[model samples]
Target: MPAVTVSNPLALPRLPEPGLDARPRPVLAVTTAPSGVEGEGFPVRRAFAGVNQSHLDPFIMMDQMGEVDYQAGEPKGTPWHPHRGFETVTYIIDGTFVHQDSHGGGGVITDGDTQWMTAGSGLLHIETPPESLVMSGGLFHGLQLWVNLPASDKMIKPKYQDIRGGSVKLLASEDGGALVRLIAGGIGGYEGPGITHTPITMTHVSVNPGAQVTLPWRSDFNALAYSLAGSGSAGIERRPFHLGQAVVFGDGDSLTIRADEVQDSRSANFEVVLLGGQPIREPVAWYGPFVMNSHRELQQAMEDFQAGRLGTVPTS
Candidate 1:
């Protein structure tokens, strides 16, 4: 195992914007009431890739896991599964998860930790609650997002980025009422540690009551903000967003978000994950865990998986 490199927070280049006075993007649409489905064994709320919608271009799917109080002995977690031609980004908000992949990569991701795995070529992996946590029974919450690779790089190579909570760069608003954690892109001049195959911005934001932050974004990329906790208004439209809602933005060079008054001490802050990337704009043939450009490629992926060519996790 190699030591994870942490980028100097002060040396991060700011995300460039064409104009400082550019108008903020408007709210294009709000997606709420995500479809509920059981994944592997645990429950999940899928924002995209549901029966109603699929493939947000460069992005394949987004799932909010648990957020449920699991009683002791409840069946939980995703067992061994195969994936190809895409990347899986897992951000742990609460609880601990153990991950193991066929490539002999395995580790635990605790609160605020992130696991970015590229299933390029192909691989088998399993994500489950650690034995200690499962026996104790507690609250579990997190987000799992799937990012697509361009056809040219779909089978480049497999890679893993295990980001610890303390290593993530945190940028604070001048007023100290807001903080942005860069997970896989530039935000407020601080760049995240994870290297991405596709250009994208992935951030976790926390805003105190009545505080606001305006951040620059590329106009050519597709952007979305998912409210994880509390309530707030987003974009130029000032559209109100609540927990479990995802707001998609229209074209613009920037976006604004403001935290509303807290209802109580428990809900004194608002949190959201902001993400965007240029669209791949390519044909997609998705089946189960494999996402390819055509049906023939999808069939090949299955064949490879059945033949055990994807490798196996070492037992020792």
Candidate 2:
């Protein structure tokens, strides 16, 4: 990867009207992405937020991992792996992850930090635990999102963005407890500060229990929400979902929402990753550590890896 070059935000594609589907398209309620391949010694992938199902566009995939074992004094880390033709974004809410890659960039990311890396052509990277955090049994909660590179920019030089927590804005709802912080796109006039290759809306929101909120959405884009902490209710049908679940929306510009009455005195905080872009609809040939548009492309990527083409670290 190279030094970060701040550029004007990329323009978004036109939207499309919703069409009746045979089923509810899984509603993103509790779907999973193709994650969790065998790691160096261990592999435990907790959740796959979205991938081909909801985001056939500017976004590719998203995953959530935690040093969640509350068994005091032990943190976890995913060792080295290879990624070609895409980017890996790590947002830390708790604990830390030390990342070193073949593309020449390496660093330790602390809590409340966002490290967005673009592995354009190819890269070999390792994510390990810092001795202090792992040995001390540090708490860890974080997410990793993958953004697809445009065809023209797929092979461009790799790079990274180490966005500090303070760099992102935080917005609170009227109740003071229900809040929203725009991460990628704009929210209530708070435009996120970071590089983007697509028009996306990724925000984190937490609503107080029983608070009724009218959340907004794009008229022509596919929209959905995931619960991070407490149960959330949305839709004309008044659907309810708990933690580790997502709810997909039908055609609508906004939603009627409320917190579950089942839990009245707990925090309803959550990480909501909103995304919408013109569907690439391109064929996807995905295997462990590789994602390509076609089987031939997949085969080529494998050959490249076998030939040691992914032997260097990325620049940041």
Per-model TM values vs. the true structure? 0.89, 0.78
Which regions of candidate 1 deviate over 4 angstroms? 1-20, 49-55, 264-267, 313-316
Alpha-carbon lDDT, every model? 0.78, 0.59
lDDT of 1 by residue, 1-316 (tens): 0011223423433334336678688887777846575556687777653322332568887888867778886637886889999999999888888998888876899888899999999999988888888788877778899999999988977889999988887776555566678888775456788889988889887777888878888776778888777889998668998777888887888888888887332435788789988788888889999999999999999999999988765675
State the TM-score for model 2.
0.78
Q: After superposition, how far is residue 122 of candidate 1 from its true place, in Å?
A: 0.4
